[model samples]
Target: MACVAPSSRASPRRFRLTSTAMMESAPTTRAAITAARARSILRAVSGNLDVPGGEPLGYADPIGKILSFNKLEMNEALPPAQRAKQLGADEYPFFGYPGWERNDAANRRLPHDYMHPPWAGQTCVGHARAVLNAMRAGRPYPVKAAISVASNPLLSLADVRKTYEALSSLDLYVVAEYYLTPSAALADYVFPICTTVETTELWHGTDFCVACPSGIQPLYERRNTYDFWRGLAVRLGQKEHWPWENVEQVWDYCLAPVGLTFQKLVEQNGIFGRREYKRYEKLGFGTPSGKVEIRSSIFEALGCAPLPVYREMVLSPQGDPEIYRQYPLVLITGSRFMPMYHSEWRQIQAAREKRPDPLVTLHPETATKLGLKEGDWTRVSTPKGAIRMRLHISDMVDPRMADADHGWWFPERKEAELFDVFESNANILCPDDSELCSPEIGSWPHTALLCRVEKE
Candidate 1:
């Protein structure tokens, strides 16, 4: 090596060493070298090149897109009010009034009236408000006696009847049911109305996957729910009342500020309007500050918790050991299936086939312990009451838990013969205590209960 200045660089000397005659003669070494060189060449090309298989591809499922579009079209046509009514009827049809010929002595024997005289002590939020207004004006509780009944999500006619009985003193009762109680039963006017699907509804569709429109014709006789209220207002002679003539007009009024028109929507057969799929990219949220508030300031301002907190549920199985001893398994009620909406699908033959009768599902171990088999008639009882259903032993359910498919009542069948339970109503088994209502959302406590089952 020559001693050269650092700046005056010289090309590096190449060194080559020839293998010994013995090594060169080895075919295995030559083959290994050849394979190594081939792999190195492949790695270099693959590293720098964008191959077809490695590239990202974008393709939409065509069938899914078509189904989505059809759903949107149906939603746009029906509206929300109609949808809600349909859902209610679809889940539970009012088979209360059979033809006059069928109302013979045999049917009359069942318990038609289950209402108790209205109590003087009970009061609800609505009743309290009325009382306060009366006190302010120096008058007695106006509009006759007030009745406070439990108004919970997924209510059944049996629940309505129970509430009516609890508040028997009242001239009028307010409860949100799919259709008006028949004129024969209710003294007041029956209001047949629409559901969420039949009205102008605005929701955060992104929360539930697709913000697409859904529409379907009302399967049974129905009317716009808002119109019922509007009609009531008109009858009451309220001068500055609801001005809308039809459901479309109501939609126009609601969406005017957002620059949406019902006519345009109808013309387009429903719009799956542009939406920001990625929530974070749209600037935090539509809140005061453009940041996710782990603690909701809005709720705090309204004297509510900033964060979600759980308080022990009233009448919960965890608190009642006696209930568990009598009813060994906990019963969870009310889960949605595709065919039914809450309690409404009984009217549709096709949907009814999906769940012909109410099923009480239990784990295999629990069934074995109880000496019960699938399709065995079992009586499930709570502290309040009990109902008989066909048992379905399944591993899908927990060993300690059971499920009674909610909303199954065939009024056409004699009450005594319907099920071993009285009235054949599930609500009879649920606690009637109003305290079971959710504190935050004002929903009734439907699930979380202890019950026992006996093979019938």
Candidate 2:
């Protein structure tokens, strides 16, 4: 979902709708997508569609907008003998869209039928594509295994039920998590992953790099992701492949090229580099053309439009009139918020106190039309399904569209209805149908779909 305002680092200021005094709902009395508004709706997240800008909304747009720079340029120029074809490159060759590094492409390969169509560009084997294909006839991949880390597929992916189906059917589903999340509960094995405070990371920038060391030891058998991988490798008889016993040794090896160790870098307060420009003159552009290709050759070779143009989505109100009639208000999911970091910080008391419920932001006028108040809980339904969210009446959103928090689950209410996952998750209202997916990249619609809201 598109952010109505840019995220501020200064202070996490949020509009608590219940406390707000005045909410004018006049400018958007025409909020419902009935006649004129239907002709000009806020196009959703695929970079293909551009909207008329007012007060700048960001984040969601950037995901697809950057695809024009398709990462194939990073290694596109590699000789065929030195390079290997990436997964889904045959179907969705929007340049490194499969999210596989060039060298690692051969390691993962799906069955022929699964490799064919309904490609999800960046969603990695995609939310639905991977699941659907794995569940397809004749047992393509003999074993279905997923080692989930830093992701809650049940909440993150579209269609909660379908996600459950795929996860349950998996031969071995391993999850690295701190708690027994609804998604983790289904896992065949759950590894306790250490928190950021219990792990080390290099907070690096263009000019300088600094070591952010772990604050405390990993508690109660909790291990970092590195050790987890190493443990797997060791058990699988690939122990020699992982020479380093722990992350510290690995960090030392990484920093050795720069003539520094992690300890040295930390003691020195990190390494600094002089700001340099025009390096392209000395070396060369990292592309097949040796220059930025405004009209990418890779796109042409892969049967995509060479030059960029604002191509309308595969499904539009004009093309899909029947669905629009059923679910009219433009429902945008995956909206970013300050209170939580994409379903992670919900367990934090401070964050929960800041924003208590899953919110569906609607124009004040739109809310009035639908007999909804700022605090009223509403059942938001799309053609796919329905989920409940509180109405956040504000002029921030265009009257014709509604924006809802995407990932919503309550750790406190774990026993209550799948941790109250299905109750308010915006993905519940989103469909994984290939028709609703972006044609060029096959990204399922998280934002562009239509929905209707009602009092719960």
Candidate 3:
């Protein structure tokens, strides 16, 4: 493995993993793996020492194990009836242990699902579309306030129109963000938050951990997320719950029970404890059967399909052939890009230059049929809404398919109307209807949709 800083002005310093023979092809191969997939693979492989490659060596990660173990223990600790009352517990009993007691009397009292305040508890597993719908309809009860973290729902959520209405209806909306994002611009109060570069991070895996110190002091009035939350807790008269005065103190508490301190851990680089492979052989997996279940018992108990299966999407060409004739292209939204994160850093000259405009990548044939030249401004439309993007005619996508970017807003433009978020926003074209979501989490189809491209 070798780290090579790219010569290109747009590319950041990146690490290259290579075998002795494939050094030349390493960069291209690595680039093919999307950032999201790479992260997903890392998460899946973390501490999985049971792989066939070698014997797993190390102690069980006390710090990491305890973090998850605490959640499981507390979940099991919840009172049976109280746990069942949790929204979505009835439908998604695997959400908590008490959910196993489906016949509980208290579970019968509460509705199978809540249309209002849509599952607002420790088990924050509610559908975004459902919650937003409740807020707009004001049925059962009204939702009057919302606190947004580093999220820009207006530009990032499916059905931008509904999100806009729900946010606009809020009596109080607070956003903590690094920039005046399109969502933040509509906030009643927006607090400046420190960036990762200005904030320390405690990076931990299942068996290894590292403490990253902030490289530089926070610029201007920016503060870390902990400080922001702590300050709010104080104002809300819940200061007792937040005893830590600073981020370091919070870190100390986290490490103290593990027989380590932030200072000590930093000195030692990190806690790389012993490895115990095939842990299920002894302690058993954290499942109902105490082993891997090919068919999830939890899902079965909750009346959900025990096995994964594909279902036809409502907005897809296959599902609605009538719409397919109008919108000929298969639209896949939000493919990951290297330079910028979701709807962020577009204002930076360096990053913006790498992708100066929002782009719709399509097959060269599709672009020609649509009368689009390379880099030509074009309108992409679905039944829900439309957005404009520059065309990047490429053979990477199928002849009848296109991939559009997400989370776009012109930071340099007027902030009065959320930087004109609807202009090139991908979510505007997405549907958040109940029929369009999954039965489990109400996950809307963002990747696959029917869209038409027209030269602007």
The candidate maximizing TM-score is: 3
Q: For residues 391-454, could you state the per-residue lDDT of candidate 1 as single tens digits?
A: 8877988787878777665533433332222433465567644365443333444566667889
User: In candidate 1, which residue ranges exceed 4 Å CA deviation?
Assistant: 1-164, 173-187, 194-222, 257-260, 272-307, 313-318, 414-422, 432-437
lDDT top scorer: 3
What TM-score does structure 1 among the candidates reach? 0.54
Quote the positional error of residue 96 for candidate 3 in Å.
8.1
Question: What lDDT would each prediction earn against the true structure?
Answer: 0.44, 0.61, 0.67
- Candidate ordering by TM-score (highest first): 3, 2, 1
Please, what are the lDDT tens digits per residue for candidate 3 over residues 1-456? 111121111223233232221222211233211222342233234432344343232234564432221221223345656544444334344433333333222222322211011122333444566557657887434678888888889877899989999999888999999988888988999999999989987775556777888889999999999899889879999777678899887777767657776788888898776654565465544455644455657556677666654456676666788988998788889688869898889889999889889999989888888778898999999999999999898898878788999888898887447888989999988997767766655457677788999888
Q: What's the TM-score of each model vs. the native?
A: 0.54, 0.73, 0.79
- Give the Cα error of residue 248 in candidate 3, in Å: 1.2
Model 1 root mean square deviation, Cα atoms: 24.1
Q: How accurate is candidate 2 locally (lDDT)?
A: 0.61
Residue 47 displacement in candidate 2 (angstroms): 23
lDDT for model 3, on a 0 to 1 scale?
0.67
Q: What digit string (tens of lDDT, one per residue) describes model 2 on residues 1-456?
A: 012121111122343231121121111223221211221222211111222332111212112111111221233445554333333344554434433342123211322111111222333243346444555421334337778886888888787878877777777889999777778888899999999899987654434567888999889989999899888889999777688898877767666656777788788887665433333344333335544345545556657666544333333454477877777677678779987888777778899899888899999889889888978989999767898888888898888788999778888985785687777777887776765654445566687677889999
